[model samples]
Target: MNFIPFLIICPLTFLAGLVDSIAGGGGLISLPAFLLAGLPPHNALATNKLSSSIGTTASTVRYCKHGYFDKRLTVPSILCALIGSTCGAHLVLLTSDTVVKKLMLVVLPVVAVCVLTDKKEATQVAAFSHRKRMLIVCISAFLIGIYDGFYGPGTGTFLLLALTRLAHMDVRTASGNVKLINLSSNVAALFTFLFSGQVLFAPGLAGAAFCLAGHYIGSGMVMKNGTKIVRPIIIIVLILLFIKVISGN
Candidate 1:
């Protein structure tokens, strides 16, 4: 409720948006900033989602304008992801949180190892037909969607890495598509949080403005620098998320 505490989050949200637009670990910054602002844990999460969703939408528009989207593959993937995430979220209600947390603690480390060791080979593939690429993207999107809905952290990084390795698509293009998927998931989470009455409107809006600026600038950098920069960023973010998840569990 204090203006000053919320104000501090604006600049930090900008930074979160910047890194998130590039490699998908924005929550690593924004959520903590919200909590430090004196919000309850659930409110911090809901408000963070609300703010980041706006910034991500901005990133999606920027990427779309730059010609990075493929509707054929992306549309199907989006649909699958929505279903998967919804199911995953529902399952979370029915399942044990401790069990899920332990599972992720184990799996995330292994995923990090795979990302570090296999990326070079993953990036080397030549090409794929539209149909094949669509199938892989859709299936992966659904699975990741479930993960996002059930427990979200590094969904974008995972999506980006999976697309790069499995689809063997252009990095810039894959980054673009990742934004779309992320935007959808964020919106889904945002609505759930919003209707639950957990979001703080003032701080959430302020953070959204800053996050928009950060994401706008970061999207430019990604287009210019290509995968050479983003790949490392993703790996680093994933590692950070892994550590954060393990520590929390």
Candidate 2:
């Protein structure tokens, strides 16, 4: 393995963390960087997960310390998301990426439009009772967890959108909670990749360190600026996902 690529992967991983920490689309950048560095698809994905899990852990801890994670929802969301992702991963073997990709291309634009237009609705919480809120969140987690597991280019963005629009979470709260859940999904995938001998630890560890730094900075930006920043980042990530899916890149 060439040692020179770390110079590139490290910075790119950090950038990915920054974007991902804010609104959830880090893999769109990091995975490409890994492949551009000449890692095979399997190695690139496995390594990317290691690096992202590091960044996400740091971000989630930051949010937890700041009192962003809702305990009532976090525990259930984690469990449901884990189980949902496992199911999605198993089902993926029987499904097709092209079909999913084409469908998302059509669906994402509509989601993006609704999210961009409704400033009030975006921040407003639903009128559900506490138990109902928990139920909705758990169900959303399972379904989106499955989606993340089956095809994950925009897992964070989708989670943010769902929670904000349906679960009545504010942008900042949604951003933070989604990070926690996304990390759960990443962990699920990483462990499998780890056992399969796919993760490239030397470079992945280096990327992880920088990714944590980026997550710190990005999460801070969201805290300070709130929806002003998170919304655009979410939109940008979605657009990037659209291109990525359509172009087959």
Candidate 3:
């Protein structure tokens, strides 16, 4: 509630936004910052969703402006992300994060390794038509959406990775589409957290302003630097997330 905390958080939000816009692990910073600010766990998570939803929305707009979004494929993923977030929110209330924490330890390293080791050339080839890929993407989004709603950390990274690998899209295209899907899931989770009265508005809004700025800057970086840079950043963030999850604090 103090202005001093806002000062500390603003820069972190900016950093989170920038990294998140690039590779999808912004929560790796923001959520821990919120918790350290003395919010209850539920309140911290909900407030995080509120702040991050704004950033992701900004990224979606940025992507749209850059002419990378395909509505036909994106629309279905958005719809499923919404549904999945709802399911995930409920699951969060009922389930424990122990299993997810353990799994992340393995998954993050693997994702990082694959991205690091992958030598596949980027191609414009349509590995699957929009309709078929939509089905696969929808299912993937739904599952990840649940994760986003329940216990979000690296949702963006997972979404981007899945899109690139499973959906056979390039990194930029996947990042663009990932924003759209992430926005939907964040909105869904935001609604649930709002109804539950778990959000802390002041820090959230303050964090969000910086987050928006970060998204703008980060999106440009991704567009300019391409996946070569994005991939390593993703790996680092995921490794950070792995440590955080394993620490179980």
Among these predictions, the greatest TM-score belongs to 3
Q: How high a TM-score does candidate 1 get? A: 0.72
Q: Estimate each model's TM-score.
A: 0.72, 0.73, 0.76
- Write down the RMSD of candidate 2 (Cα, Å): 4.8
Tens digit of per-residue lDDT, candidate 2, span 1-249: 678878767887787678666545566667656655656556766687788778778777878889886777889899988888766655653445456446556655664554444443357666778787788778888898886665455677677777887888877777778878888887877776676687899888988887777777876773654446546655555565556555665
Inter-residue clash pairs, candidate 1: none
Q: Point out the higher-scoring one by TM-score: 1 or 3.
A: 3
State the lDDT of candidate 3 residue by residue for 101-219, as single tens digits: 45446654654554444444464646688777888789989999998898777787677767877888877777778889998999999999888787889999988998888877876
For model 2, the run of ten residues with the poorest summed lDDT: 112-121
Candidate 2 residue 144 Cα shift, in angstroms, is 1.9
* TM-score pick, better of 2 and 3: 3
- Clashing pairs for model 3 are none
Give a tens-digit lDDT track for model 1, residues 1-249. 876876668877887777666645666567656755666555665687788778777778878999897767778888887778766656554555456546655755554454444333236655699889998899888898887765565677788878888888777878888888877777776676566576789999999999888877986773653445545644554455456555662
Clashes of 3: 0
